[model samples]
Target: MTVIGFLKKTVAVPVALAMTLGMAQADTIRIALAETPSDEMAAFFVALERAKANGLDYEWTAFSDEELAIQAVLSGQMDIGFGTPYAAMQKSKAPLRIIFQLSKLKFFPVTSKKYETLADLDGEPILLHSRGGGTDSIANVIEEKVGMKFGERSYVPGSSNRVVALVAGQAEATILDLSNTNKIMEQHPDMFNVLEMFEVEASDEALFANLDWIQANEEDVQIFVDALYTTWRDMNADPTIISKETNPDGPIGQLPPEILGSLDDFYTAAVKGGLYDPEGGGMKAAQADMEWYSEAGQLEGDPASLNIDDFWYMAPLEAAKAK
Candidate 1:
């Protein structure tokens, strides 16, 4: 997929300041991420820089995983979180509302030369990310769709860790994100092969916030949303903007030089894969997310029964796109 091709086809903030709400603190919007810092989030940080330029005060913290991130947001320790804990939010009746769909699930099940197909791994052990992560969710769907189930499950949070484990003979099979998959195949041309998997119209990340906070900070939220949408459009139009805004002292630059070499290739694949949504503010993406999660058994009952109003708040996103 050419970068320009995606650009040709696709057409696609902050308030938390000076508030005397129930919690007493500074005005920055407290944001939380489900995972530690990595290159995937570089462009988001660039958007935050843009938001700062617009005088939106914000700060973010990273949780060990999405589960914790959701908890933080529900407890109001953070104003917003970067993950989709749909089931948990529904069960708890948490006032969380998804404001942005960050990225689609563009994962691949990859393994060493020993396994050539998904059916070949019926009794083999597989290494994956956390139980509810993107790779893990894809594996769940693969099992149902292909009528095959692996033998054992091992959890290793990062794709790079799983890749290292596969190479070190600690595991025979694992699921990886696109960039990691590319890096593995590039390094050991004959060692690993990606198993064919069906496309999952699922979201890997989203921006969600407590309903009350969003209502109170509408204008600021719109500013942040608009900044993020602009970031996606800008980055898609020129992949080099990612590298341009990458702070040398920041997370992306701190990655090993070898991983940095694959940065351009990674974004190239992302654009081709349609990982970033062109219009992220509507029910279209949310509907797909619901269906995918329901199919994966991550949510209970029929997806059609899940009301969009319960899970999403699209006004800010819609307003952002209008700008």
Candidate 2:
């Protein structure tokens, strides 16, 4: 079985190492990853390798979920992190600023065949990734749109785990990422159903950092963002580029050969599903985020009134595009 297939069977968290991309130094950016290494993050790893090639020094630690990753960045333990921490940013008034959108909110609500639509999920206990993570925000927006609240929310931390729960009959409903959603349906089409979800354009994941750190280390940040911008555009042009450019010794490449072989397939599906923005999701993403998060209850005030500059620092992305 493939590594992900094995993971689905055992519901295990994919292991991640504390990897440093270059010789450690006082200025090495410490990144807080929201989840362990998996196929979902292959493109990001390819970009990281490219940045390292261009003299961007960095290290990363994998947290169990987005909340922990956000806390690490907030507490000064990490220089950058991955998550949509709008609530934390607003409440803490920290100088947290998003630099690039990693992925859009392209999730699927998969449920047992018994539930036909979003309304049928009313009062149903649902499994999700984490308490305040992307899936949690999606659930909140779903409840608001459908005018019905979900019952007890069980946190599982990985989409594969949630898919396992759904397949094993441990969960009646849950949200999943594009690949996992496809995997389960293809494997057991008669067991579950993918509900028709409304379109979501806001970011599901993003690269954010404390403003002070970003200003203090503009060179490194620029290199990182530039590399990401190039990589994203290249992937959108030909998703197979991610699999081709991936460094064999890198985190993503160390996964089982089965997973490595499917990198092209994963990225192709991601791009087709609108999981990424070739432009790195600058102002358009920022505006969409304000509206989506407001509806998701993670941001207060009218989306129009919310100052996007308060959350997104667009200079790096703008500079990258100008090149």
Candidate 3:
């Protein structure tokens, strides 16, 4: 072959191989959300941008519920699943590991214009979030802590519906999250009473993947976890980052003006209320989560029997923490 042909053969072959390798190395993680975008979900989307900057690319699919999301992750259909199903995980023997705790259950108990405290709730028909959900969990804790039992419990899903019941004088009391809680307080500032409630020091959501998937993609998992750690830390420091990073045309921004207007206040309240845990991943969180779920009747058996390492893998988060 001529010198020109030889150069072409060597250069072109190596360049093509390099392109293939680059394509193979471009780590793109697929994540599944348990539900549609809410304030916290939108905050995570903001963190996706941060994750990209750290060499991890992502594609996401939102499941209608946590069960489906967990199934998807378990089947290897998604790289990560949100809203850790601790109870389901143990029951089904899913080989999943929690690498990050997203947020805690930030709920508020709202009532009619009359009730003042947990004592006032005694012997009165009360509305609960669901038969067995975060709201009921809180209600159970309240009953035990204050030694009072509500007269009748009604299952009403959706904070808005429960809020409507409270406003319409249909239901006496119920629990709500930050957004709906704020919405209620804003619209009819004096009509209802948002009773002071205790903060559940338990995990509401988590980042988890199949154990095999995590073991195989350790670097990508670390990048994803680190990005989230940074996002939570930064958001904790400055709640405004959410508003700044939120796409004005995105889902959160497109929410009704009332909600959009109160976004800043909602986040400010969340940050101050300890919504996000600074230690995104740890054994302490894992243990606390197990205890809470056990008492709530969601998880069974001894909390001590459950191994934190089996459920929570903290290496990625420890690496991400900017200490």
Candidate 4:
């Protein structure tokens, strides 16, 4: 899957920030991030700090979007990336496979007061994060379940920006993550409605890499996954653990005091919302993703017929659980 050839000309070499961690080892793992660092990444950074303490050296570059991050890994420019690159994997038939499930499809369909329920918004224009991103896939499943198709689809990059668009009357219907959804509703409860959405347990964000790379870097990969497993378990048990463990000198900690201050509130809400799976979402998540993505038109063939191992390498996660 030479996705590099096309992207190499367009995708700029992502500027690596001063986010490197651990002792400078001979082999530093290159990580491709889908978005700029923010509150949502605090837990991940905490896990990285844990892995760093265990001698897992690494550096990360923030890509403009998830596609670029996936391409960076697929092209061998980076060893691993953050995203749910199901479409890319299916299209390129690359040996790219997900190792850890970062978060589930916990998005909410928010709309103006003109719509009270999902059915009322039939044939309405909808704003989404990207053409083939998590929001678009959620919209696909919504249409399938609600028995109605949207009128027009528009693309907007960020959930906060989409909420702004809704507030400014640019678009009435859109999907948003838990944090943004809660913010908009709390701020202006009278102006909008969070329509009832069907339950979705599919992987929304995940850590994926090429299988060959995983095999060659098994040690570092195991350390990273083990840290993630432990951090996720601790976060589920006590959501405030993320804020307490955040390094004041790190990227997440460098954000504005407002965001840093609310880390506890955000993570507490996220945990109660069932955003992260304590077990790292190995086989169960792989199976749910097959069904969800297939229904959303990201993958071909029957979901039951698809091989889970083709999209997920579960050994590291299995070892994490064993220990």
Query: Which candidate leads the pack in lDDT?
Result: 2
Comparing 2 with 3 on lDDT, the higher-scoring candidate is 2
Measured over all alpha carbons after superposition, the RMSD of each candidate to the real structure, in angstroms, is 8.0, 5.4, 10.8, 5.7
| Residue pairs in candidate 1 whose N, alpha carbon or C atoms collide under 3 angstroms | 13-223, 13-224, 14-220, 15-220
Better of 2 and 4 by lDDT: 2
TM-score of each: 0.88, 0.92, 0.77, 0.90
lDDT of 1 by residue, 1-323 (tens): 11111111110011122121225244567777766567677777777777777877765665666776777788877788887777776787668899998887888889888888899988788887776766667777888888988788888867788889988988879998877888789888888889888876678889999888999998789888988899888878877677777667655677788666666767777877788876773688789888888877778888999888888999998888777
Model 3 lDDT tens row, 1-323 = 11111110111122112212212113567676665566656568667766667667565555555666677777666678887577656776668888898888788888878888878998888886545445666777788788898888887655666788888888878888777888889898888888877657787778888787787888888877877888888888988888788767545666677666666777788888888886684777898888887777677888888677867877788877744
Tell me the lDDT of candidate 1: 0.75
Model 1, C-alpha of 112: deviation from truth (Å): 1.6
Could you tell me which residue pairs clash in candidate 3? none
In candidate 1, how many Å is residue 267 off?
1.3
How many Å off is the CA of 22 in candidate 2? 18
> What's the TM for model 4?
0.90
Better of 1 and 3 by TM-score: 1
Candidate that would win on TM-score: 2
Evaluate all candidate structures by whole-model CA lDDT and list the values in order: 0.75, 0.86, 0.71, 0.85
Off by over 4 Å in 2: 1-24
